[model samples]
Target chain A: MSEASTPTPQEDERIKETSALRQALIRPELGGIVGTIAVFTFFLLTAFNSGMFNAAGVLNWSTVSAQFMIIAVGACLLMIAGEFDLSVGSMIGFSGMSIALLSVTFSWPVWLAIIVTFAVCIAIGALNGFIVVRTGLPSFIVTLAFLFILRGFTIYLPQTLERKTIIGGVSDVAQGDWLAGLFGGKILGGLFTWMGNAGLIGVFERGTRAGDPVVDGIPMLIVWAIVLVIFGHVLLTKTKFGNWIFAAGGDAQAARYAGVPVNRVKILMFMFTAFCATVFATCQVMEFGSAGADRGLLKEFEAIIAVVIGGALLTGGYGSVLGAALGALIFGVVQQGLFFAGVESSLFRVFLGVILLFAVILNTYIRRLITGER
Target chain B: MTARSTHAPIIQMKDIQKHFGSVIALAGVSVDIFPGECHCLLGDNGAGKSTFIKTMSGVHKPTHGEIIFEGQPMNFEDPRDSIAAGIATVYQDLAMIPLMSVSRNFFMGNEPTKTVAGFPFYDKEYAARVTMEEMSRMGINLRGPDQAVGTLSGGERQTVAIARAVHFGAKVLILDEPTSALGVRQTSNVLATIDKVRKQDIAVVFITHNVRHAMAVGDRFTVLNRGKTLGTAQRGQITPEELQDLMAGGQELATLEGSLGGTV
Candidate 1:
């Protein structure tokens, strides 16, 4: 009788334990997850109101994301390696313009033009590396110089390509399938192609007056994104080259002591990042079917944002390839989500800013925790 | 070649002179480090102790005199050459990466690998297995090999570095104040590690300013004062108190002792 009803603190403790078990995760990253959900829901509702879930809407976002994913992968690598390549955005414009001007205006083979363009970009990356290594200059300053110089090149590059004509010619490297397929080409033959890509020709589809024929297979953009992610992850994790990257960023002195040529690694990393930008720029031309001077303007920041969102520490010791992949997806989702929610362009920019700020804070705190624990 | 005798003096430095940028840091210092014996070099701040160790370790190339390692004339341009020559110096700061695992730091640049068609395949499993085996041989019972090195105590970190040198076939291990900053228990642990290392037939050159700690493990003692060796004496030749007197600069010690003025 005494055990059943009176003075039983054990049962009370058990009840208290159950209640405590329901406590929520209050960490900032948890807040990020919650924010992600809230934003996603808000976008879905707007999309429903504005009919953004239509086939056209999907196509639009896919095209935008396809262009972004390739460059974002390289930025992610650089971020994980504890460095930055601010010149990438400029590099793409310059590289693309170089190829287009060479191939279309100069009557050069598309392959040769592409090769020459990439070589120039690689050289620029090496120069950036050499300057960084010799001067111990912060990459931020060096790459920022590239940004302005490249932008200036865009204004004058057309003039150099076609001095006789008053107006410069636009290159068609993007529309060239051979270059596209070589770098990040797509071969799609799947059931999903029934709607996603240009659908089966005349398979009981309405004529132009009655209804538009459905066209679908794989989105070339998705193809580029997938290929880039694979390349980034493998290059970073599975190779000796990747090991060098980790060592170089982790501790330059120790790495050098251990016989890792750190300056060479840095130069290579910059070159690799530039090559990634060129690939991305190539895809942009293919997808858009044209190249211009402002092709890759300010896109470097977007790649950086994706990397930071993906879980890379800025201080050069820890980074993740998968995180960058996920980060790119997150960027896509946010952009589409904003569009679907019927938000104004101004509002979209504001939301992006907020998300970027939150990501920066969370990424920094996690890095601190890791460094402090050790 | 047969290993140096357990009792033979493997490293014998005589009149070692080293200058750094026109500063005569170590001037005419001599010490004999015998296999299987713990030799201590004791001195106060700026007492040429660091310079002596640097000269021995090949960090700073000596200006004059000889460093005989395993009965060979030694001139090491860098620490890597010295390490290869079986003379290992563990710096005070300990160059192990804090974020890396104990096993990774144990092997570090000299990680063991198996060759597959002339290509190196880093046998990670073998490294883990051997890191455990070697560390246990050094009398360290760690929780796990995968544990981050920063988790270990100062003494344990020193032991790990010492154990690495031993496993890599270092005949003469020079510890640069390895236990100076460690707490009492940790320092004792280091002394025990030094003892274990001595049993393995390695000659240890223990550098420190503390007489008590030095006396705790020293087989032969050398004290330096102001860029020169005051004297090098076998432990049996001089009492600890006398050693302490010499290290404290006997003139100041005498003044303090004289104040007691025949009170006894």
Candidate 2:
């Protein structure tokens, strides 16, 4: 018999080294990386003279991206698990209004109100998952119905309680509350103040003492967004639960046959999506100190568009949290860059539509190359 | 071969009957799978082959019958219970996510995890090494354990599924129509893999409609027609042509062939 043709130890090492480069190229996040660089370059060329690359400009876009990333990361996870939570935008509105009405109107403690708001969001999320799994209906339709239901409630709640669609004075209730500081107020406030005093960075003048810079402390929204992205990336790539998510999304029946708890994984994913939406709402309510029924309008579609741009398949089972984070960054850059470039704000939507179309086509082409699909 | 004869059956289905409302999918079928043997369940389409195996694999509960596993009457509420009880069913579709890596697919549900930095993480390195080693034992030299399962040939995919079942402590491996979608070479490769599995002292219930393929690897054969068992035979006791005739409902095909003669 001929000698077996297995690779030698040295040959194996060489093969691994070469395959590493090939592997990196085929990663799902590669498209997002490319798109981020392209968008950053475009903005730098057109809007850099307007201080878009400076510390203050960077802070503005990063803060917006962070808020979007918070929801986009969750949306990315749900998409990877092969589902959608279209009610997320509505959940944000509903959750923000709930907190406002609870703390301001009912005179409840800010902490207690926050907890109740989360509980309500979690229940709504679980219901969405339960109905979808039990009836085997498309999550898109089920969550779409929730979108309207929650939006209607957001508008109706304040009208009933305060005789107006807007709920204000949340800041008054949040004042001196440590929980509010943790969720809403600026982080690194002292450090940024020191930087402003030392003339190292910009700070707010009118909102603070005289001679202060234009931008103050870092937004808590940015911190939460970054934390969520890292948490999501680890959960999707490292844990056994992450593997189950991929399996369930890829093929539910096959996942069940393989002994994966398909239904439970999906339900938990839905709950996580709602939880992220609540977190977004908390940041928004705390930042502005008020909430309207129109809060977070069209934000669900934005998160989904970001996920798709990150190279996640619309069908499911393939995506990256880091990619989704970058996708959110792209959205923030375009949204703010347009203002810096002196372009119409409405034109921002046109740019988003065009980017989403191109990103999806590029993502699909890359996925085909990686999966070797015809 | 004679030594295997003395071993108790790994799984025994006695008078298994499964029905779906007005349709009788399986009407009193029985099968016994012995260790260190490839027991081929031969039948045509709609002969209740899938229904019979689904009962054994715990995909469906037998409407009227008993499944004695390891000499104990077993009732599985889910496929998870069956897997834990050491029965692994590799369905015709293979029940595999194509985009996943070979190592991920190998330990899909039953993953090995190691705690690191106070958190549990999938032991990917160990999984990949084990998957590669196991597939090599079955004579499949994979390019890499991280390669997508979709990129593998039909035979390679089947081998991966079989190896996964074997690695997960499966005492009885039930393969459903594994070679039906494969080419001739891949079919032979799978048959050889079955032989390798049998030598490992695992009971394999290989279900297929192809008589010649069954004759190649099967040590014992069970014929089914009209959702009921026709008979069981030790490999050499039944000729391939006789097995084919029985699988096609005895003399019906022969009579049809006679009547259609001289058509040209």
* Strongest candidate by DockQ: 2
* lDDT string, candidate 2, A117-175, tens digits: 99999999999999999999999999999999999999998998899988999998899
Off by over 4 Å in 2: A1-22, A203-208, B257-264
Estimate candidate 1's alpha-carbon lDDT, on a 0 to 1 scale.
0.71
| Whole-model Cα lDDT of every candidate shown, in order | 0.71, 0.88
Superposed Cα deviation of residue A39, candidate 1 (Å): 6.3
The numbered model that scores best in lDDT is 2
CA lDDT, candidate 2, residue B193:
86
RMSD of each: 8.0, 3.0
**Candidate 1 lDDT over residue span A11-45, tens digit each:** 22222231322222212224335554665676666
TM-score of predicted structure 1: 0.78
